[model samples]
Target chain A: MRKQLPPEMLARDSRFVRTSIMDQILDPRNRKISERTIGPAKLAPGRPASADRARNLMHGIFTGEIQALEGAGRTAFDFDETEAPFALKLDMARQCWDEARHVEISIKLGEWMGTEIGEFTEATFLYEAACAPDPVLRLCGVNRALEGLAIDVFNTMKEFGDVSGDPVLEFCEDWMLADEVTHVKMGSDWLRRLTADDPERRERALDFQRTVDKLFSLGGFRGETEENPIHLARKMREMAGFSTTEIDEIAELSELARAEGQAAVEAAGSA
Target chain B: MSDPFKPRPAFAPWDRRELPGLFDVEESARRVGAYKWIETRLFEALGGWIATVPELDVKMILGRHCYHHAWHAELFDKRLPELREMNTDRLCAPANDAMEEFVEALREPDAPELTIEKLVGVFRVLIPRKIAAYTFHLNGTSRVTDAPTERSLEFILQDEWNDWREGEMLLQSLIDTPEELERAIRRQHELEAIVVRAGGITGLGTIGATTEVEGAGV
Candidate 1:
């Protein structure tokens, strides 16, 4: 037996029917085209040699993404404790759900690429990177760092998806990018609060930034040369709250990665 | 073991009036002090990452957490005067030390940004576990009170449980990359050791050990 509430009472209560940002973003009414006509009818040059490989990679990425979303959810829950400011808790809750949707969208994209979500392998770098014990660090690494990169990745994918006339990928990228911006903003706000008084903490955050640079500098399999290396890396950092100095460091790191990646490719060609 | 006097539901949503003796000025003051220390540490850690990490999302999230913690501190302040007579020396002392250590860690000049592995290890592995323990303690004692304090604790406990779940998921997701994942796993072990060392010094456990120890001394 459940208690029944009047319509007026139910309507008056805000929490009972709270709609998340994800719900708004994923609504079918927002769809511009049907799924049938969304993706490419034919594969492009330099596309992964096999759709199977592409699907596998996408599945791995999606699994990592989902895990990060779960972590963000936990942080939000903890913040809810001690009576965290109502508005902040609400915002965190919103971000948690958005991340969940981002994972779902990515999974769908993986399916479109022709692969099922894969099992967690020992080689999952993104998964490991997000396995921190501190709330601040978890937020910094997953939401700010990984998802920050994701914003750039999605934007680039959106451009490619649009040019390739792949409406499904484009739609996914667009919605994800919008949600990521808010997620990044949430991380920035929280990071600022945590480090306001301490210079050492600021330095450590900068160090993490450098790590991001090193990790992403390897460039993606899709085509490193095609990407706007400097702009892509710099913009992501800037959004994550890097200062002018830190941004310069990131740029330097990106250039180094390009050089190294090129050298490896040339060596392989020669061999 | 079921008493007729017990509430029908094992886990009913909390009602403030049910817990009458929980919100003593002294206890509230102690909890506020502990929360303040935790808030400061969280802020410092997040700030450290933002300054170093080039990833926009990481910076944004850290900044958000920092702001929220500051707000928590402000709210705690509002409750301080009410317990002005309570001896908060013990609660305040270890917090001071932790704050000092955090500041020292932050001011050490620039280096390579911590690897995602390291950052996540610290944030997701260590911090959430400690918070969970703290919340559990509160939950265990909260029901003993027949006052509003129990209600507040209930709310916090629910939140902490959610936090733990999310943190575990984050940790599990790091399986994508070997190197980064390994580093995070190592760091988690290291955090456990550090927390254990700190735990013994303060009887109230790791999350608020300093404050608890300080309160005991007072």
Candidate 2:
């Protein structure tokens, strides 16, 4: 009989546990001196009122997203046991923790911005749509669709922060962007594992993509252009194993969204 | 630019005992089972697709992925004993029948090329999500002082990121056809939905929950 390898052995060999981006970001030297200070001092009192309000609103939205993830993280941890490839399970657990930490970071940022997390009245709808009863659908919606959107958002925020010379926001965006990629990868990995055997699963996946595209477009999560957001989405989907045809469909959907937006404006002008 | 050349710090120790306030062992078990079932089924499907591909490089990469899946299965299977020891009921739920059927369909001798393309699509969509998951964990555990589990996750996140990058490179290099690429993306979207749904059913929502703020009192 073949001797079964211990979970410890498998855990030991796991690449997910050793080289986290968090470790890179939290270097003692990288630790900001300002993090130690709290409250109004963190924000310049003389900053323009409008600028402060905008920052506060952004911070509020960020905090709300974090609160939303608290429940989401718990859900992910609970599913850790069902995740196969012991490495993947470990990865999933890591993801749960990562999301939880994101919430913390966001909350801290919110404090700095002089705002608290707002209640998300539409939270249940987002969760219900993303968290279906089927594992495949769940992965597709949350991991591929929602998390994929996150990558785009973070990347944009990172670029915006860097260009605008905001160290604090840049730091947060950089950290979040790196983690967002990994989250999407986990979803891709499992999706590949789950549907590897079914020829028809591809069609099923396409259907899900269409639904996600529609949902995101309608929800205003995705932009109506084929620029950075669409490109990033395409890159993410490709990494997760999207076929060219499906990508074209996504592109078309994006174009449709743009067209619809234009038409709506035209109709409004006529009215 | 603020300190672009900051020196990298020594790796931090990861603490496993710092369980989140809402840790649910039973839910974790269910998730593990679900992950295993999905992974095994995907492996079976991809293995079939690899068989049909005439290209040597494609076959080689697919084979490596297959080995990874096998390793993943072995690791998950080991968890069964641990779950049993913990007296976690509902640990023995049967594998997903729909996933099994999907695998069986792929196993058919003359499966169409579109089917293989779909398999590729699934991978394209799911990998980035995994990358995001790893990075999230890495960021979350950064504040912990001395935990083995945290250290372990750091490594895992890095490797997973590497895997995500490599998978993207492979998709670009190995797949020559546009149709193949499109199918790959569509499949990816589909799998994402499935994973999210699974998490909800198994109460894996904790995966996204916030950690209670650790005051200096701890």
Candidate 3:
């Protein structure tokens, strides 16, 4: 079978709406909101809009889980034993089950937070990353970058759940967070093992991962700063087999993105 | 044949293990391999379809069933070696060209609108035959000597039944109009022919046969 199924082919019913990264970037509301906020747009418990913000973020998580399920399922189905090894495909299959559970959980969590399905727009970026032809590159883009982003997002949600005194949110987020960790670990192990012989190949995979990480950072959406909504999740990343240096590099990327976002808001304000 | 061994209750149907078995080591291994191959392809196909189906409820149902098929494949993997066979990779392939064509046909419906075709080929055609084949194997086998394979078959058969029921519900929901009913019926007929030509997922004369192959050890 041919590999690299395109993102446009992904099927969604009429209730769902699509948005692009450019749409987010060009939105005048973001620039105006950024102008008023002093640092990064941090999510906290006491803010008046925090509940809706959390609900919006939960909807995003629901969509992201669906894409993550698609990505892992594709990795399991798209590759042959010659390309991806039987053991790796089995891991991918296991990850698919995990993702499916996460999808269900995320849906319940969204309902608990008073949000409907398709309340937020979805970008097909995660599944797009899985469209890599090379299996190793797929591992890096999907397992590492996309799932690594999940670890951070889930952890952030768990903390939000904990701080907000929402037991159901806190408990479910923690459970799904654990699965995301295993998923990231699986990706990291497969990426390294598959690329051990070819440093150049490894570098290429790493570069692809960096590009995705930057892209998902979404001009400072994830970072170390107090302004960012999601943190780098350094401890969780380390548990998932990321080196200190790699984690630091992701932090640097997020910092650069945050600075760039702040500059954009200032530029728009002045203009 | 005065219904010998027939007096037991449903759960305790087999009280005597004295019979050697319906299948010896060689034929059992081959059929297990064939079952494994079919399960592997099924899980892979369902996994591929999860993202492309437009109906959210269908996607969620497929997500769960996809994992169930994957686990069924794993169960076959675990069962292979207990039959004195470590060469499962050798056995894990389509039983014949017709079987391969059957599975290939299963994955052919790619677009969102073709979800009915996809489900029809699987639940109506593939899974029912699998249930038949697996039951034939499990019931014919000696519960005394080959209980492991029998046990594996039991689990896989349960999953097949559950998955089949769920998929049927999906078909009933999606097939509202007469045209959709025709689509479902036509797709089911096409796939049934392929499986029938192949003699079932295991082989011809395997599932619905009145008698076993002439030389089986039983």
User: Individual DockQ of the candidates?
Assistant: 0.02, 0.02, 0.46
Model 3 Cα lDDT, one tens digit per residue, A171-271 = 99889878878888888888778888999999999999998888888678999877788887888888888889999999988887777776776676577
lDDT of 1 by residue, A1-271 (tens): 0111111211111111223333433444433322234333122324445344334445545655544543443344334334334344445545545655666677679768665544323133454454454455655676676666676566666665687677887888788777777777777786677677876875676467557556665532222344432135345546656567755665566667656655555554445
Restricted to chain B, the TM-score per model reads 0.60, 0.57, 0.88
Candidate 3: stretches off by over 4 Å = A1-3, A29-32, A38-40, A263-271, B1-15, B208-218
Q: Write the per-residue lDDT of candidate 1 for residues B1-218, one digit (tens) a residue.
A: 77889668555567433343434556555655665555544443443333333333343444444444445444444445545724433454333343334333332322334435434543564446535644544543434442343444455445445544644554465356687677666655655444443442123443333444331221
Worst 10 residues of 1 chain B by lDDT: B103-112
Candidate 2 lDDT over residue span B104-211, tens digit each: 433332233443444344445444444453344334432343233334445445544665566667666756788766666665555545444333212233245434
Candidate 3 lDDT for residue B7: 77
Interface Cα RMSD of candidate 3? 1.7
Worst 10 residues of 2 chain B by lDDT: B209-218
Give the root-mean-square deviation of each candidate in angstroms. 17.3, 24.5, 5.5
Fill in the DockQ of model 2: 0.02
Off by over 4 Å in 1: A1-57, A74-93, A119-122, A219-224, A227-248, A260-271, B1-218
